[model samples]
Target: MELNPWAVAGLVLVALVTYYLGHHSSRSATSTHDFLVARRTVRSRRNAAAISGEYLSAASFLGVAGIVLKDGADATWYPIGFTAGYLALMLFVAAPLRRSGAYTLPDFVEMRLGSLGLRRFATAFAVFIGILYMVPQLQGAGLTLGEIVPGAPAWAGAVVVTVLVGANVMFGGMRAITLVQAFQYWLKLFAIAVPTFVLCMVFFAGGGPAGMRSLGAPAPPVFPKDTTVSVKTNVTVKVNTETYFYAYGEIDDGPARGAAHWSPAVPHKVASGTTLKFAAGTPVPVVSDIPATNDTWLHPASGKITDLLQTYSLIFALFLGTMGLPHVLVRFYTNPDGRSARRTTVHVLLLLGLFYLFPTMLGALARMYVPQLLVTGDTDAAVLMLPSALLPGLPGQLLGAIVAAGAFAAFLSSSSGLLMSVAGVVFTDLLPGRIRDFRVATVLVALCPLALTFLVRTEDLSLSIGITFALAASTFSPLLLLGIWWRKLSWPGAMAGMIAGGGSVLAALIYDTVCGYTGTVPPWWTVQPALISVPAAFLVTYVVSRLTRSGRPELVNDIMLRLHAPDPLGLVQDRVVARFGQVDDKARTGRGRHRKA
Candidate 1:
């Protein structure tokens, strides 16, 4: 249980930088306008960096690589969908969303549809989606600190991240965190990119292209050296061939728990708190659901219809979900105008594309170097472990520290944005739109998700985030797309569609999680509900909207004009100012007709 001093130093440095930036930038946040939208003065490039930082949550930083390491080629779709979702946003949603002149997604819903009820409904879902997305970031933090500082409980990391993020948001709000997030983005990029370059150089120098070819070999990956794996959670693994290992825990569902030699001819179950030691050259035992051989893993198609369905469903969710994410959309509101927002999206696309390439490479390398993680089913630690595993000694420890700091940065930046979005919704809709209420909302929103981190068992970080995306895709995707593009969308229709879409995804998530806990295999749709839910949302919204055409807002034409018209035309009004006070006004006395609506 020895702690690495270098890693601790790296984490402390990032925390100091984050706090300094937050405190320095917070001096100007005297009004709700600055706290909520940074007074809409951010330019394209810096805003893009902040958006990229916030968008690249634990799922992107850790989950993508872990999934790729465990699932093979199919995992590539996760990043593709993630990046392409922004493409969808850039093309159809980004400029208009910014032009809508709303501080939050619920604000947009109410501004467009003119229904207080619908705004509250959207607020509820916004909080839900934010919390759902945040759980992964918190869990990833737990996984990371646990790996670096041995014997640290998972909750310790979650608490540390929540405290840092909560303080940043409560004190500085969006204005301060913008600077912090932008800085962290470059730091995260360096953290992942440097290790990838060094490891690739070593791999090529060792075996060149021949080493690359070895990854595709038909045999299962083997332990590069004798390794001891600690299983923190119960998992069932499939042994491809006869293997002997020393184990100290409950095995094969037995009440007797003690040290024993495990030689399994069939699948084996290992209980939590188990420790197993494997000899060098022992074939790795992977979780039962993962591919055991490299050949099968490298291939794109699993030849199963369910696999095909799941892949397409996942793609659909990710492609449409970006626009629906509350944290991502709120960043655009920080842009000065629609044009800046569009440019920011373009820059984000480029930044995200470049960052994603490294994680995929890291995952491929992990298969060769960190096969022991497969047995414990804790591949989420692959990115943090890879540097130390490959380099060894002081160099590896330093690199590991760098990666750990970057991972924490990932959690902090993403959690800050999510908490900001959720707090904004709570402050505006649930509480009075006051400056102090904003601070309270930040505390309230952070606590709910922090508590949730303890109850929900951590799974694949990317997959858990994907479910949140599916919820976003099903609910808000329909609302935003139809509200912006369709002229006849009614408030009742929007509410109904959100319920249909959000309800289905939530049901599937609960059922699937229950199945996982009970050791039962759930159906494919339970895992990826976008294919069934997204269309239902759009269809229900359309049909109900058509049926309730009379309920359409009379101001729909004005809203549409503002959304589509160029910024220079001056059709878009400053709704933030209309609801809260002006950026310069400290009286907090500005409430217009729209606030009442």
Candidate 2:
């Protein structure tokens, strides 16, 4: 399945254009707003696109499809969970967080707590989470590059993406990257959708791509309007004189991407054939060995406790983590007003919902048409390979090229944002006082993550990303949410929470990684530290506030006024618009000479 040269050319073009745009935008940037928040001038449509572009990584595009391909209905929850989490974000964090008018989480921390020490701790944690998330994006790019260019080594792709990302980050900062991400989002949508439409037609035509027929396409799992599928079933197995009800379908070893697992042999009787079916009110035969089938994350050995805890833990991490992500939170500061922030979030949900629908469909299609992906053992490649299989020769290459371009866009856009976030923290939060030292810090931040990429290797891109989320959820989420709503929060409380919550999650993460607790450890202990740590932070904040009571509330009127106000003042908004950067529309608006933010 070597990719066509033309496809490679298309990918190269996207990289060059993206780099060019980023570099050109940053040349004139001078102020803190230019470096961090893009001057709070971005329009709703572009801002929403940038948010979606940064949020949807290679993991969502390829990793989710691969999971669905291998794990039947159980994998469907990943997309549903991802999209539903955003609704939580819109309701709880979006407008209010923006109303605070902080650039990074650290900026918000300093404003809320008025403690430089606490701000530094929060910033350091933000850097850690950003780097962790950036690694997988680099790896994904390398993999896609290898597939697209045949003889191209994985490291070559990683290097290419890293260099491009660094260039983008160094050039325009947030303002420049914002424009690149906005364009890339639409390109990604087309890249995935067109190939999917073509393949669906191919599959239904009774002649799928070559080798697709032998794999036996199955009917996709349908979502029941109501709770028709049982929450769980007791599989009674008779072994000699003993009756045991054990779970079936547990991937005991690792991911189902061609990995084998061990299970006890059991004899079962069914009224039907090998193809199992269950009608309403009918008793379905239970395969008591395999766990986590049908979008139900169950541990057969335990009664629903394990699955229930896993679900809640995952939900907790995603809900809180959305607020903590430095890149996402940073975008809120780019909007002109609280209303613009709200509008941008609504647009994000719409764009992401539309984009997410396509990926879920692709995953379902892979399950039916490309079941042998189980043999290849790289489910993340499902999105890339399926397009090639469906369209042969030029069309296949073109599709492959498009997918590669989008994958690279996902990798580079995300890497660029993370790098920018890390740079901002290092420069603005960590560096003592000198502007020269801050510039050096920016270079150091970018280079450190790029160097670390060589040491780690893994195929579980989605899981790696989830780990980063867990860390962010534990640390910054609690701090930000509380700081925004509460007036009593002081430097001591914020600092105590930072060390207690952030340090604990970091320690747990390091221990988990080193101890080889791989295969998604028990959900409660593994999902996100927020479930335990968030409450602990609240307790610490409460205690610390009482002990070191600050007579005056910091920024109380500003925060409250911003939250409840209809829109920004006309003059203030005009100043923001005058300073805001846009691609190709500067001259038309007669705002060209101003510095880019």
Candidate 3:
């Protein structure tokens, strides 16, 4: 079956209605504050939902399942690392950063260090990271639309999302995007949650193909039923336990695509637009890139040194990276105050943890039931295809539709936030800060990613997003953390560190993109740059800040007072939490001096 029309229609309908409502309710943004940070009036719960909506991008929505299906237990660590990054944010940066009262990261930089130069420097990093993140989201949209309407070109879905996102940000700015993103969070949750439940039930009832533990095994999968697999793209696969395979196009070392190709003992190229018919009991072939065995896939990095190094680097990148994401920090600015930001982060942690469980299940399910995807290199389509592969008839179609809708929601919510963030910065810092300038800024910031989506050729959704995180962690994380928590962090040090860290990751991104060096197998030490880049950033910041003090902002004391002090005069503090929980006379002055010591 190629392209489900009903599913496609439902997804487009959902996008149109959500955007219409957001456009309808757009708060006439009259100032830079309104466009950039929603006037800092968002409450905890609502802000939390919007944050989760954007944060759960295509990587979280669909890439997780594909990673799990392809890599097995070790890849489960990816979700843990992602979830932990938010926790690190809650404890280390959320409250104080919100308390800083800046609309954007660059705004915060200027406010903290009293340097227009550093702010502009930060603006550059924000733009780079934002475009990098958005490109993959657009690509994920292409992948999703292709799944919905097979043979659909890559540019179609990207253009659709770009138009919707542009309209929402252009008219309403943060306010409109917030509402749209919040709606998407629930839609995405429902999309995946319902399918996971029904799929689980079916597996238990029908007693799934072989054992469910076959994931990562090199052995070819035994087809449970005579299923006809379609090769949507060209791929090379080596047939395992050869049988009388009836397929179309050039096969057995010939180019992929066409009919009447027999399965040879050796590896052959399967062209696009080809159909491969296999007897239900035929053993499936393993593709070229991924491992062929269950043990390696199931227990990846099983005490191996390289895997361990790669895993730790990934963890560090994610852990520190959350604090630096331009879109994420923008959400904190929407909170009513520091306390509300903290509270919203708690909500985010719980929601993400609960949502990730379903992806793990789906990944395992795909590996067991849809192993043919390994040959086609469409593991990313696992979540989209699992429902129909498990349950047939109307029920499967409906669930499949839900998943497709959710995937589209993922693309919309994430790209919406990132675009708003990058655009807001451009409006405030690059161009004039007039309210109407936001529309122009939105167009300008979007062009890079939109062109990238169409021109550069997108790759794995999760991996590209990961590169951005590594870049952010390397560039801005140390700056944010040090600026907020350290009194001695000078503007010079911050600028130097930002350059050092961001420059390093930027080099890696360029090298990989230009040389085609980044792939399933990459050169040593370059796969995740956080290992070197993050530390280099921190160390540079510390050494420079300690050595040079000329650029320290004179207002550092005043900024610290605001960050650590209770809402002055109760004007900003008048919320549901009436009293200052910890700040009373002595705490207000300074949490009590180190007396006896």
lDDT of each: 0.88, 0.64, 0.79
**Best-first order by lDDT:** 1, 3, 2
Model 1 over residues 1-597: C-alpha lDDT tens digits?
247789988988998899888888887777788888987778888998999999989999999999999999999999999999998898888899888889999999988998988888899999999999999999999988888899899999999999999999999789888999999999999999998998888787783212222586798898888788888888899878778778877778874344454444678888998888887888888999899989988998678999999999999899999889999999999887898899999999999999999999999999998888899888998998888777778878888888899999999999999999999999988887888999999998999999999999889999999999999999999998888899999998998899899999999999998998887999999999999999999999999999998779997888899999999997766775766766546353232101110
Query: What ranges in model 2 sit over 4 Å off?
Result: 27-30, 209-303, 432-439, 515-524, 527-530, 538-559, 562-597
Runs of candidate 1 with Cα error greater than 4 angstroms are 207-213, 255-265, 576-578, 583-597
Please report the candidate that would top lDDT against the real structure.
1
Q: lDDT of model 2 at residue 428?
A: 68
TM-score pick, better of 1 and 3:
1
What order do candidates take by TM-score, descending?
Answer: 1, 3, 2
C-alpha TM-scores of all predictions: 0.95, 0.78, 0.89
lDDT of 3 by residue, 1-597 (tens): 556766887787888877886676474444455566765667777788899999999889888898787777777877898899999899988988887767788988887899998889899889889998899889998988888887788888898899988888888788777778877888888888999998999887865554333544566565666768777666777655545667766565555443343354566677777788776766666666565566666666657677778787888888898889999999998886788899999999988888898988999888888877776777888998888788766777888898999999999999999999999888878775666678899998878888988776555567778888899899889998898889999999998898888888878777767656333445435667788889999999999998888889887888777777765434232111111122123322242111110
Top candidate (TM-score) = 1
